[model samples]
Target: MPLYRSWQTSHAHIAIWEITETEDFFAASLGFGSDKKHPKRRLEHLSGRFLLQYLVPGFPFDKIQISPLGKPQLADQSLHFSISHSYPYAAVIVSRQQEVGIDIQVYQDKILRLQSKFLSAAEQLICANDMQRITLTWCAKEALFKYYGLGAVDFKEDMPMGSLQRTTPEDALIDMRLEKTRETCQLSGLIQEKFALSYI
Candidate 1:
């Protein structure tokens, strides 16, 4: 299957790509030099530069710099964005107005080990039997944190999956409470054998 998928939300534009390796995409698309070959560093470099290019065509090199908060910013400040990746995919969301975030995770046993770090007690009870549900919950909260532009927020202590109402594969509601601020967002996705790729 192709590695890219995208949709426009009421507040922002979202894009997701399934990459076999992050280095291949960054090196080819962003013109990274030989010295910047490490995957994590390359991704950080490319993601900021790419988003700047998206906001301003032919933006000058010296004008691109990430903020102290780690948010990408062009000297022009035309738009805002966030990016994330897991084992096989990288995702980005761009917005002209509201902040946005996107994340993708491949289902793995390691998620079980990390559950307490990301899930609340009530969330665990709600998703105990359904592995896909648990993964989706984790991804949603991570995306939400990224959307908030706060890195390293504890998913269990800082964010909780609130009431959820499932309507259909393409139309479901996910409510969340983060740091006394409440947000209700819609989640849409198709389920593969063991993974669910969610979008909002």
Candidate 2:
């Protein structure tokens, strides 16, 4: 199976799929009807849909709609789900209990150059290593953005990092806050060999 990892709780579940199959495989397996000009994007979309069904058996994959903010939602709001992809992997988080978000990013050195765009000066000082810190912050903000399910969010100004603790070489726990909504939550992260995964 392509499922790289999965986490389950009483209210929510997260599944990550490693997209090693060809685009034709997904198109045929999931009945992907929409034609995406880019092969990678098409694979991501279909893989996300496939992971969604795996999480919720018999989910109406064809009835999903996009919100004004670009969030994909079920037509009847029967369930809430979020999908994210970064190159070779696609992640899906589903919940029948509450809102959810998930993000997976392949680690790259370029994130250091783009740190200021999404992280504040104060937040930048919290991490010991530039690459790992930046990747975690980016993943955290991305997950937060999905949880908010709204666009027009300023990553540096709106989402702030409260606390960052590295428990192991491949795992970290983060406390994040949204300034506009006054909401706060903890996000768990896994620093894999090739990519980093964060979800809440």
Candidate 3:
């Protein structure tokens, strides 16, 4: 019931969950644990793993290994996944055939000031000072970074977002370029009143 929505892409399944349950619920249900010091952070950590198992039955939680770049991966690479959380919400993308990424971010006014660090001058202008657009842009690139799954990426230079193409009032498709791979990919995104979600 906590699963807010799930979208099945051609090659992967993306799921988002509204974290309405207590940490104990996840801890007990999944036999999962987190050592995060903060309670909310601890909850987010548990919920991420919970969503993974929810998306893929019998996910090998015990076999997850962290790469040198701190990306969690399966040694056999049997499944490629990315997990992200913004407090009360958590999301995951899983693909047995391809690396995947997903991100959910609660809108924050402060992102306006920090935009320069992650967004280039041109990318900022593309946002046109709109917080929803700004947040979606950040999420879009962040999704790309996770998709790359290698650290030391420049959000400003590595991924540039094109103008948003609004598919629906709440949903949009963003064309983003992956400088690292010299390829372009369209990130599917949704802009809500309080948050933005993106996946690649």
lDDT of 3 by residue, 12-130 (tens): 99888899899899999788679999999999999999989999989999999999998999999999999999989999999988988888999988999888898888888888888
lDDT of 2 by residue, 1-200 (tens): 67898889677898989999887777676766447788788888888888887888887977889998889998887898989999899998899888888888998888888888888888888865467767877898899899888788899999999988889998899898887799988888878878887878
Q: Write the per-residue lDDT of candidate 1 for residues 1-200, one digit (tens) a residue.
A: 23466667777766655544455565566565325676665654565445435544564656657777776555575666666656355566667786666656677877777777778789888778466677778777766776676576777877777765556753445677667355555555434454555544
RMSD of each: 3.9, 1.4, 1.2
Best-first order by TM-score: 3, 2, 1
TM-score for candidate 2, please give it. 0.94
Lowest lDDT 10-residue stretch of candidate 3: 157-166
Per-model TM-score on C-alpha atoms: 0.73, 0.94, 0.96
Model 1's TM-score against the true structure: 0.73
Report lDDT per candidate.
0.62, 0.85, 0.89
Residue pairs clashing in model 2 are none
The number of the candidate with the highest lDDT is: 3
Q: How many residue pairs clash in each candidate?
A: 0, 0, 0
